[model samples]
Target: MKIAILGTGAGGRCHAAKLLELGHEVIVGTRDPDATLARTAPDHMGTPPYRDWLAAHPGATVCTFADAAAAADLVINGISGDHALNALTAIKDQLAGKTLIDYAVPYVYQHDSAHKWPTPWGFMPLLDPVDSDSLAEQIQRALPETRVVKSFVTQEQETVVDPKSIGGGDHTMFVSGDDEAAKGRAAQLLREYGWTDIVDLGPLVTARGLEMYAHFHSAVGLALGRRFGVKIV
Candidate 1:
């Protein structure tokens, strides 16, 4: 299957690399492919430039967000939380009648906060539309024709792609979406990525819980000082 990963961030790269290894044709989407490839330095997250990463994995194709989505059978939205809605909306025509697995948490960085939850790197980014609404739900509303499934937001991208790295791949992965078939597609991909335990949280609104868990996920990672996984059992 041809899969489009709509982002060039570390998370997107993780999915792209893993998908290529899984024998799927991968198309990576970005706002500007040229600018994404011209980067010589790492991103704020310190993930190396896209060009450097692409060099190691030449099988994946990089193009504009719309072009990638147009060519894909399925789409994984790795776009940053703040920009995903607008970015996906811009390519609405290409994504109609397709399953969109959104893993982005709507994080508004550098916001004013009376009580800051500082991390080893910086303060925890704020999640807008957090408790009552979620980025996944927002995207679903924005693109009425697209089937949106929320997954992969509960864990770091590394663990998401290679679940065996923690707990012998026994951890639980959750999927939430309005479309059953779309959620099934996401579960299939997770299984391909080596996830053995998956729970369907039922309906897109459950995405609020997944997105809101970001803070807790970060807190646990900081406390342990490592990458970890969570299991329902």
Candidate 2:
């Protein structure tokens, strides 16, 4: 499969690394592709670094956000939560008819009176706080023609990359989307990343629940002084 992953942070890098391992042609899109390459060498022997990873992937080469969306069989939005909407808005035109795998959490932090901390100690999950229409719903509305599947937001970056640390035996992933085919495709990619146990929560509306789950995960991690993760029983 020809895959394009936007953003080069830990989440993006992890997805790119796993995709490369699975023998899928992967394109990594970043704002400063050249600087990114200069900083980190390609971990995979055959993989190539690119301001435009599409070119190295062969049959597909990286261009602008619009180009990547238009050319790719699958487009993974691995950008940070704050930048997800803006990044996708930049290439909205090319997203029609494409399958978009959205992994984002809108979490705003506020000081917790109970903690008596100067800075915000608790996160305000935007899942319910952000009006009736959630972030995923907004994206779906913006690109009606595109099939959007939401997944991988409940867990931290580390857990997704190395499940073993969090009782890797049968880690679970929750996926929700309006399109069954799109959700199925996303599940296939999850399996490629070595996620064997997946829960299809059904429809894009279920994303709200998953986002709240992420907030809980974050809160628990903060309280425990550790990087918390989840697994399915």
Candidate 3:
């Protein structure tokens, strides 16, 4: 399968490497291929440069966002929350009639708050479409022809791609979308990633809870000083 991961961040890298190991052709999308490869410093989260990661994984390819989307049979929206909308909307034509598994949270990284929920990284970022709306719904609306399924938002990035590392893979993952087939495809990918328990929370609106769970996930991670999994039992 040709899969396009529309970001070069740590989360995107995790998916890219896993997909490659699964024998899928991985095409990673970035704002600028040259700029991404030229970076020597780590990202804000201290993730190593793209070039360094690319060196470790030789099978994966890097290209512009549109090129990657155009070449892939399936697309994964790993773009950051703040830039996902604009970046995706720009290549709407390429993504039409494709299954896009979006795991982005609509987080506004910069905000003014009198009181904030502090974490190991800093105050937790604010969710833009909190309560009433979700990033998945927004992307679905933006690309009406694309089948969008929301998943992978509820777990830590590394644990998401490698569920067995935590709790012996005895946890649950959730998928939400109006399109049944798309949700099925997303669940199949989760299974390939070693996830045994996947719940299909019907309709894209349920993404509100999946995304909003980020705050609680962060709080728990900080409290535990490590990554953990959630089992729906």
Q: How do all models score by TM-score? A: 0.98, 0.77, 0.98
TM-score of 3: 0.98
Error of 1 at 72 (Å): 0.3
Q: In model 1, how large is the Cα lDDT of residue 165? A: 94
lDDT, model 3, position 174: 98
Most lDDT-accurate candidate:
1
lDDT tens readout by residue for model 1, 1-233: 99999999988988999999999999999999999999999999898998999999999999999999999999999998999999999999999999999999999997999998887788888999888899999999999999999999999988899999998998999999999999999999999999989999999999999999998898888899999999886
Clash count in backbone of candidate 3: 0
lDDT of each candidate versus the true structure: 0.94, 0.71, 0.93
Q: lDDT per residue, candidate 3, 45-164, as tens digits?
A: 898999999999999999999999999999999999999989999999999999999999899889888888776578789998989899899999999999999999998778899999
RMSD of each: 0.8, 5.7, 0.8
Candidate 2 deviant stretches above 4 angstroms: 32-63, 108-131
Residue 17 lDDT (model 1): 93
List pairs with backbone clashes in candidate 1: none
- Candidate 2 colliding pairs: 54-60, 54-61, 54-62, 55-61
